[model samples]
Target: MPPFDPLRRRLPGGLRAEHALALTVLALVGIAEGQRLGPGGRTTPALVASWLLAMAVCGALLLRQRHPVAVGWCTVVGTGTYYLLSTVDGPLVLVPIAALYGLASSGRLQAAVTMAAVMVIGVGAGALAGTGDVNGTAVFMLTGWLIAVVALGAMWHGRMAYAEEEAALRATQERLRIARELHDVVGHNMSMINIQASAALHRLEKDPAQAESALAAIKAGSREGLRELRRTLGVLRQVDEGAPTAPTAGLARLEELIASSALAEMTVTVKKSGAHDLLPATVDLAAYRIVQESLTNAAKHSGARHVVIRLHRDDAQLRLSIEDDGHGAPPGPAGHGASGIAGMTERARALGGALTAAPRPQGGFAVHAELPLSDNKTATERSTR
Candidate 1:
């Protein structure tokens, strides 16, 4: 037994057209044979009645796909009566053939079995009593064709069910991925922003300038965090319509980040000595995020007020360095992140770049990442035009 598939179901009008065509052909052939039965029998009321009944049975197939079990049983019963009255040939048999498979595929094994039994009993009994087409090769051939149709319908039902299940599984996995990314982005930023906002609110009356600036930074950080989250969700959309093709936070936005760092209580410097060219969008965005996260970490965890951020580019690569004059080394995984060094490392690696953070023997923490330019050469990656 197979379940119904809404997506795979054929339209009602199409199914009706198919059934009507089959029955029309069957009826024409049947009427031709009856006309050939000689003048005495051709116009008999009993003969005419049988022909009309058989024609009605053939047309019954219009309901086959929708009510397969009911139609199949009705076909079996009507076919038996037509056979008894000697006019069940031609398109009349199509009703049973068309409806039988749909019955078997409608997720009702018991009903399918009952209909199958009726068809077999009706046909077998009629053939035995009337000496009909049972002994002919065509009988076996037609039975084989009908059975194949039933089997094919069952296969379709199974395949459709499997496809739906696979689609649902994929949707669940996507939801989980979105959940994880949102949690990582919001959890980290909200905690820091909340603390800063609470402090600013408490000091609003005492130090108006410091409180106002703190509140402003909180608002900016929160807005940026929301923007990043929205971008992540956008990736899950089915269509690319109206969505940004590339990330917005690239190297060009570095100055605003430096200002945020200064507000977060870190002394930040930006030094670019070489000519600046447009970087590959992904690389530029990664660079900015690396710098931003590092500065945030310094503000939160490091005792350092002084941080140096240098973006230097050669013909082949761009090197970004962030060093904090903070308390010794970060203790655990998030050590760099208390200021955001660990987050910076992750951002670098995600863009096919490499990151290294080591304790400065003289003082704070130093973070470095080397990103390859599209026109540049590196020992590991040689980019081509």
Candidate 2:
């Protein structure tokens, strides 16, 4: 069944749903008042006064959204006056009940509760005094209705608040994910270009051919970096338009990544134990980014000449290990390397996985990550296609 949306009840001529509800309440109360009096009593002063009080009580509801407490009190006073001046038993009580819901939904819980208590007491006192047409049973039922309406309103308010908070949290996480992507793309390529430029300058005096190769590598890295940057920015700019159709980077480009690291004078090796394809897209992208960031840090901070990357896939999970023969922990008190590691850890945790980076006992720095492969139905389907 479709969900219940109150806004669908809008009347003709742009009348809001609340306005319709108020008019409906007014009509029902008028009918009840007519039933209470015969045709001979139609033109009586008491009936005229009762109709006026009912209109005032129901009309106040039109402003309930803007002034809930005031409208609630107005309905309460109007209902009390109607009962005191007239001997008719009618549905005018519903007006105050609706006002109580408005008050509770507006986060005015104290005022709503106080108003409900006063209403219950007033009805009970009227029954005790043998005034009006209210009895013990009617008062009891009205009290229950008032309590239930207030509770439902409070629950609706809480649900809306929770939904808003969840949306804000998702927006925050998306921004952080984009930040990590930018850092990986820009930082890695810039480091490679800088290193290649230095190499070209140093080799220009002796080996002209090697210097030209280094310059070529710099141009290639810059071009690739610009492509990736544009792709990431595209997602940010068109977020509200629709879903982006750009393909994300994945471990399928492992060879290209390794070649880029080699251009920076680092020998990178890849070892695979099992099938490496058919992983979920999210896990694949996160794994690729982890490797890219690790390589970037190695090129920029570590004086390592060799790095080994291992990928192991079993029935349960995919494991990644990247180790570099560098001066442990990337020198200096935790700065860029620390933030990079933190970002990697966040990515893994977001995917229900785990990642750790630290200095290996024997010599260099190592990063280990584990991503589960249990929920691979969708990924498997995509891979086969």
Candidate 3:
């Protein structure tokens, strides 16, 4: 069998030490009370007996915090008996603090309150009997210690509860972060591959060499993206994912994308305005995927024979618009019709981009997305990381 845990092994030894110390104190007080003093200013037989009795009662308290309710009641019964039977100090006066610590930490608010009330009543009764004087210093001391015990216990328990809550929150946030990263990986890569493959298939007979090139790019792109994905996941295991990827595809894929759709005899026109080069990887990937989804949907469902794809960029944003004379938007629930359009929107929104879809007045439908351009530094960090 495996060895016992260090903490658990130490626990029993610590408890034994505490119990032994309590008993030793009790025995010393008992013996001291039995000893005779040479002169007048010293202890009497009654005082000695009271101290001995108090020690014995206090010794019962060693396990009070471990079993609060049981120990507390034991203290009350033993202390009350000793007070009534012999004119000795009240039994178990050292127990209230331990019982209070256990009660507050238990998470049983009602039980703690009930125990507190019992302690107050028992201490009052002990005071009334032990000193035979209602207004005595012993009453004040007991009351002060009881209040301090309960307060300290409550504070320590509160700290422990807060720590548990913070840990849970951190775990939840980490899960959300991982979910978002995985979404980007799977969504962006698959959309591009599907688009490029469709394009290559369209011209495969006419331009066999180019078709082969596109096919090879598709394979290489997918492999590189998968490698990057593994690296992203490796962070969770605290392992290095090796090198980051520079999986080469940009605005150039738009031509192959449109040309492929044209192979299906669906005429496609692509237009660009302003400087569209050197975009953030995420924005570029999102733009490609959005247009890719639009073209794919046109081929899959739209009856419109002609398509228009427009790409535009200014200083702050990149714009993509795709329209076909195909049937206007799917009939009902997004999931029931085509799921890609909605997924594209979600992908765009993840990068602080916007997507819109609406029916055309004449016929068919149009899909467009505008993505924000984060500063260069942030984009570089995302790509390299």
Per-residue alpha-carbon lDDT of candidate 2 for residues 112-140, written as tens digits (9 for 90 to 100): 99999999998899999986478999899
- lDDT of each residue in 121-178, candidate 3, tens digit only: 7657767766574345656776777677667666656666765555555565457545
The TM-score values for the models, in the order shown, are 0.59, 0.84, 0.54
How much does each candidate deviate from the true structure in C-alpha RMSD? 8.5, 5.6, 8.8
User: Which candidate leads in TM-score?
Assistant: 2
1 or 3, greater by lDDT: 1
Give the candidate order by descending lDDT.
2, 1, 3
State the lDDT of candidate 1 residue by residue for 1-385, as single tens digits: 1443642343234565556665675667576557646566646666776767676676666666666666677777887677667643555665666566565455454565566556665565646666754643544565566567567656655666666666565565456545545654565467458657877988899998989888888988788778777777777666645784445767787776676566656678888867577888767866876766566556665667899988888777789998889874564754435334545554555455788877788888787898877633321222211
Give, for candidate 2, the lowest lDDT window spanning 10 residues: 5-14
- Model 3 is weakest, by summed lDDT over 10 consecutive residues, at 3-12
Q: Provide the overall lDDT of each model, using Cα atoms, as 2-decimal numbers.
A: 0.65, 0.81, 0.63
Measured on C-alpha atoms, candidate 3 has an lDDT of 0.63
**Better model by lDDT, 1 or 2?**
2
Off by over 4 Å in 2: 1-15, 28-49, 201-208, 237-247, 330-334, 375-385
